[model samples]
Target: MNIDPHKLTPRARNALSRAGLLGQSTRVYELVQSGEICYLSNIGTKTYRELCRYFGVRCDGKYPARRFKPVNAVYLKQCIHYLRGHGYTVIEPSQSHNQ
Candidate 1:
């Protein structure tokens, strides 16, 4: 399917870039599929620091990678469902969808 990045807002572009970039990986795969929805696979941000530290991997650290979970209603419901299902204490909105 063809998707338009320009249609997204600046904030959404940032968040989706992270998640969609991860979804582009040959080595990595999506945990949950929601049509064209985005998900970050335990991977940290691809910043220089994150590259040196997590290397797109998931692990415990002070500067851990974050996912894009929108505070908006539709995305909020989805993010909360996953977080709650998995048992998270502090239910914050997502950038990682589940980070």
Candidate 2:
């Protein structure tokens, strides 16, 4: 079943866009093929799990109700490098995580 990006929440679509995974390059394939959604800049695990559920993607994890925080800046930097190698034009965030 092909999941349409338009069917997902605006936040989810934007999340995929930020990760360079929207459009023809949506990693929905990767999600289904690899069973993993690589961490993106602004997307958190909760949003991710929600997106997964909407798309019927099977990922291994537990999602208990709790406070949701933003993605860690350090982790996003790590993902930036990995995504760049995949032909993604990822911009390094200007705001320092230190502050």
Candidate 3:
């Protein structure tokens, strides 16, 4: 699968920025270190589902689905950890080192 940076919507971009993940690859890892997120081993690429569950959203899909609106910041942090444990590495912002 290929990921296109340009395909990311403005909202997604803003979310990434707020999470301090903008223009970086290790942001997910950083979020984990911050104690703002947790990882679950069975979700696979459905990290979003884990987040939705965290927010108490229920799914009506046959395969067990959940929906979350506007995506919560705290949930996104959880997603970062989920992604990291699944072999996705996030890039930390350069300035994060000084702080």
Candidate 4:
């Protein structure tokens, strides 16, 4: 399956944006390069887990609730990248990425 680069779904974009991931293209690129953000294979889009790993947040699986907090744009980008890398393609707002 081929993915059209021109169109990205609203849901996909929103997921990234709400997580503080979307913004000026250059800033996004820079954040990605600094290892401040990463793509996650499990969570679909840029997720808090990636950021946690980046920030070295300790977790013993005792508190799942505390796992997500202080989420930022950098983490969201990682989620998007993660989804894309795992054979998921962003098509349109109404359509889901094919894995």
Per-structure clash totals for the candidates: 7, 0, 7, 5
Residue-by-residue lDDT tens digits, candidate 2, 12-97: 78877776566654455665334335333465566667676776666465632112222676765666677667765544655764
Write one digit per residue (lDDT tens) for candidate 3, span 2-82: 223465554444444454454553444343333232232222224433433333344334233122211455665677666
In terms of TM-score, the best-performing candidate is 2
Predicted candidate 4 versus true structure: per-residue lDDT over 37-96, tens digit per residue: 333222232343333343345433433322432245566456556656654443222223
lDDT tens digits, residues 44-67, model 1? 233323332222334333433333
Candidate 4 C-alpha error for residue 83, in Å: 23
Q: Identify the candidate with maximal lDDT.
A: 2
lDDT of 3 at 98: 26
TM-score, model 3 to reference: 0.25
TM match of model 2 to true structure: 0.51
Worst 10 residues of 3 by lDDT: 61-70
TM-scores vs. true structure, each candidate: 0.27, 0.51, 0.25, 0.26
- lDDT head-to-head 1 vs 2, winner: 2
Flag regions of model 4 displaced more than 4 Å: 1-12, 39-99
- Predict model 3's lDDT versus the native: 0.40
Identify the runs in model 2 with alpha carbons over 4 angstroms from their true place: 1-3, 32-36, 63-80, 88-99
**Distance from true location, Cα of 54 in model 3, Å:** 21
Candidate 2 residue 97 C-alpha distance from true site, Å: 12
